[model samples]
Target: MTMASIAAPARTAAGELATFCGSLRWAELDEAVRQRTRELLLDLLGVTLGGSRVESSSAPRELAQGAGDGQATLIGTRQTSSADWAALANGTAAHALELDDVTTESSLHPGVAIIPAALGLAEELDASPAAMLEAIVAGYEVTMRVGNALNPASAYARGFHPTGVAGAFGAAMAAGRLLDLDDERLTHALGIAGTLASGSLEYLSNGAWTKRLNAGWAAHAGIVAARLAGAGFTGPSTVFEGRLGALHAYTDEPYVERLVEDLGRPLQVMRVSIKPYACCRYNHGLIDCMLSLRGSFGLDDVERIRLGVLSGGALLVADPIEQKRAPANVVDAQFSAPYASAVALVYGSGSLESYSTEKLADPRVRRLMSVTDCYRDASLDAVYPRQWPAAAEVVLRDGRRLSTRVEYALGEPENPVPLDALMSKFISLAGRDDAEALADRILHVDADPSVRALGTALRSGGGST
Candidate 1:
């Protein structure tokens, strides 16, 4: 058969990896790709540490305690659960704070959802850490390309969180790799993961904790699917392109071609944005611009703040409750543009501490937010969903005006966050001891045979917190 015929069979065959899993060499990846992966892993660790402290994390820790027997670590929660449950617990904790890294195309918290799931299962299997990283890299590529084919707006506009719905499959891909599932087994794992995919954007309207749970759901589902595949279960191979399949039901329709089109050639997670603030990724540029002016203008001198952005940016943070407008719940605060922008100008950036009710409702913070106005700017909206930024104007009581605009946020591939800053951020969130060691270990993750040794030590036998 010619090359084209071989490609055709590869696309249509049952155990073909649409069965053959390519062992992508780390050395083959460009230095930039490796560098980006390290940065993302670092940011993910920080977010997971902080998120592990959230109240949402408490439920899982409680359950793990009740189970009374298991051998898996719950991230920074200092608890233990069965391997699968540990994945669920850590995954939930990692995303509970909503500070996890997000990719533009994956349209999901790729790091929080996929990493914990992949790593959690890998630890249980005592799989080679390098193989685990390769799986993660492959999984990231699949999800983002699949998201591209998904035409996310179809479900997103209808109040469903598309990322969670699709992220399960990505996590499964990673699990399949670590489990060493051959073509048929990998196919079964992917298909089995389909039934486990769930979550809706309705939580945004209710301020529910489901938003955080969605990430954990993906991690859990992937682990379960992998377990079943290992147990000799089978599943349909054409999960995505089937007549009444995941694509037909959830998205406009999956562009099947994108699934393996450029699989090993490029890495999608490398392009992920490491958010500076806990608020929505859409609002970061405006927050960035505001923080820039706050330095020169001073918070006390500012009488009013105005944030202008593209339509998509505005939609993300516009809310119903006046409290949501000014926010009290940390979850709610992350969705409030006016509250976030004002806080950044008055303060600096929104971290776990910034979104507490006390901070959100502080009289001075409210005063600044009350004067804040969010508007749609035609120029910014023109290139949206691709390249869009924010412009902020600060009007001072002293009759002075200062304005700043950004075309891109700081942590994008183009304008990356420096390693020094990433390390400090990690130390702040995870404590210096844990952060420094994990940073060195994971940056070279592709080389290690097993991360279990490291994971066991970090299991935080603080025992039930």
Candidate 2:
């Protein structure tokens, strides 16, 4: 399908995305894509419910509650807030746990930004389940496309978080779809959202809560942009590839063809990885390596641990080795390779609980981190952004060395976690067996008249803090 059939003064990038978003239909989506949407939504709802109770979500949740107009339900809570507020609150919560679905190639977590906006607006406008799913697909496509074009590793090195930057477009696509905006209005929404996009990688160094709020902020801004556009507001149609636009602003070189390549023929959402561990996607392979070797050696038998990770990833999670060894807080610990490897080696697992303050205070974990070393493997740099590969070696007290390497993390598309496994994760995170029943309903959501049933089910079962 051509990006734009509309007569244009110029066939701009924004016009292409607008055309795609405006014309996308559920009927054109493959069965696999539809089923994947259900799986992604189920996981997203579960993680949002789990994240809602985290300490980081407190201020936003309180703010949303204070600003409430009952337009939408805040995933875990029975309380309601305006669509934008709800999106902000829930989107923040969704990302707080670091369990959201992600496309590693784009370095964007699709569900956190898109799902909150789509679900919030779906509840507010009483949009159908089919529409919600279509919105979700469009959101993923646009977000990943923009992220892909940016060359995420280079963007990351430039101190930008791709998710926070690209997520605005994703949320806008979803919101525009739900609003049923035409090509022109959807183009305006993209332009507005592009200007609104912003996020900093500084949070990685400080363990600040701002990183958790980036996707949520983008989601909030996108909803507002879409609403404004629907009200006939005008925005720059050349907002993408223009000299002063998002593409040039975010990356040194933008591969703009990636923005519309293959369009909807092969859905981008299918490429996303559902995180198994609650940490940065860059650290997943390292953690997986540690998890794999946990039973082979004892933490007490270890004298030192060494990690070889991609140079780009080292910039995010493993550099400044001392800081990684002694993280200041849970968020810091979550992104620390030494800390993560230590947690896995000492405890035989890494979960949401593993990054808690109490766990951070564990003497064994601390001692392990102190002995752990993380360094860049220049040899593995070529495989990065496509596959997050890691190599690990443990030096034991008895003069024995055990080593392993993992090319794919447990939840990567190449090594996917099964749907049943995802459902089990959903049940655990949602904190109720009823999540299974909800998953059943979500699988057939296309047949539902409205998305309100999913919202209703979401509010109940699992997580109330």
Candidate 3:
């Protein structure tokens, strides 16, 4: 399939987004959408709490604490700071563990950027849970729409991280909704957000900490953009379709019509996939297939393992086979399909613990990774971005071969992880004894008058306020 030529939209991208953000209300969402929104929010927050305990979080957490005190709450810690600072800290933490929810169509993590912006601003304004939910829904819609409009595979190939770039719009829309901005002001916010959106894919080349910080930076940029627009700052209205704008600068071809196509019939959040593994979303299907095959194949008896993946998916994690097999750190392992597959073979699982520093040196993991081969399959590539299909072939030392294919990962919309499973996953990551009760409160957050109560519950576990 080829990208279509960009055509003039009946309405400008910014104008359409402004109209949607200004008029959207949580009540307009169906019951399932509302409940899913709550689930995703809770999931992200749970992971954020878990992420705060990781070593990478120290810098961001310290930065937020140094920014001075305010109403915003940091997810894992008991600290408060200015809204933008809190977004930076909380967004960073949400993405640190690679456990955040993903919008498969756009290949972006909406909640990492949207939740921090919405929750931070909501706390500052003492916003109602209904209002917070509205911001999240609006944020997700705008982010995914813009993400789809940009030819995502081309963008990634051009060395752009979709989450960091698309996240700015998600953050801006959420903040704009919470600020109660009119269509005009919200349009300005989106325009400003488009210019501020930036993230490099260079981090994939190394186990650098930059990937963890991209979402936080986007969240911070969005809050500042929204605040500027609310203060009467004007930005170019045609930021998306402008000659020197995001689409022209970052993508090969822009599907401009997707920005507002089928505006609100099906809420995008309901289609998002909550990750079960602490690895890149691109590698999930292959990891699923590998884990399923683990029970039958012994590490010592396996000769070679092959993975057939979408060609575009290989660009991010599969190629550079040597680097993928010898990931320098946890961040590197999370994006490496080879490393992830090998871990699944040796350990029977690929949870967050599997990426620890000590695990990287496990001789068994390295031996298995060295023998794993990943290549593009025409069939898999054909259905990518819509269906993340993957196939696994295992060769035994005795010449016996076993193969299996998976079209959807466990957490994908087609085969969703149930709420009970989600809750247990959250508990495992959250590390709190009373997590179930806290989760109950968060799942029913729509009924709460303000987000302050939930914020208090999160902070009560640890950190300083």
How well is each residue in 229-274 modelled by candidate 3, as lDDT tens digits?
Answer: 8887777678888888888777997788878889886878878999
| lDDT ranking, high to low | 3, 2, 1
Worst 10 contiguous positions by lDDT, candidate 2: 1-10
Number of the candidate with higher lDDT, 1 or 2: 2
Error of 1 at 52 (Å): 1.5
Residues 1-465, candidate 2: write the lDDT tens digits.
Answer: 222443333478888888877777888877888888888988898899889888889899889888858668887887778889999999999999988988877878988999999999998999899898899999998999999888887887788888888999989989999999888888888888978898998987789999989989988988998998888776778777888888888988778888888887677888899998888877788888888888886778999999987876777788788898999998899889998898887776777877788889999999999999987786677776767788889999999998889888889888999988898888788876676787778778877888887777777663453
Q: What is the lDDT of candidate 3?
A: 0.85
TM-score rank, highest first?
3, 2, 1
RMSD of each: 4.2, 3.1, 4.4
Better of 1 and 3 by lDDT: 3
TM-score per candidate: 0.88, 0.94, 0.96
lDDT of each: 0.69, 0.85, 0.85
Q: Distance from true position, residue 1, model 3, in Å?
A: 45
Model 3: residues with Cα > 4 Å off, grouped in runs = 1-10
TM-score of 3: 0.96
Clash-forming residue pairs, model 3: 78-464
Best by TM-score: 3
Instruction: Show the colliding residue pairs in model 2.
Output: 430-462
Q: Flag regions of model 1 displaced more than 4 Å.
A: 1-22, 26-28, 65-70, 77-79, 252-261, 296-304, 320-324, 395-401, 432-434, 445-449, 460-465
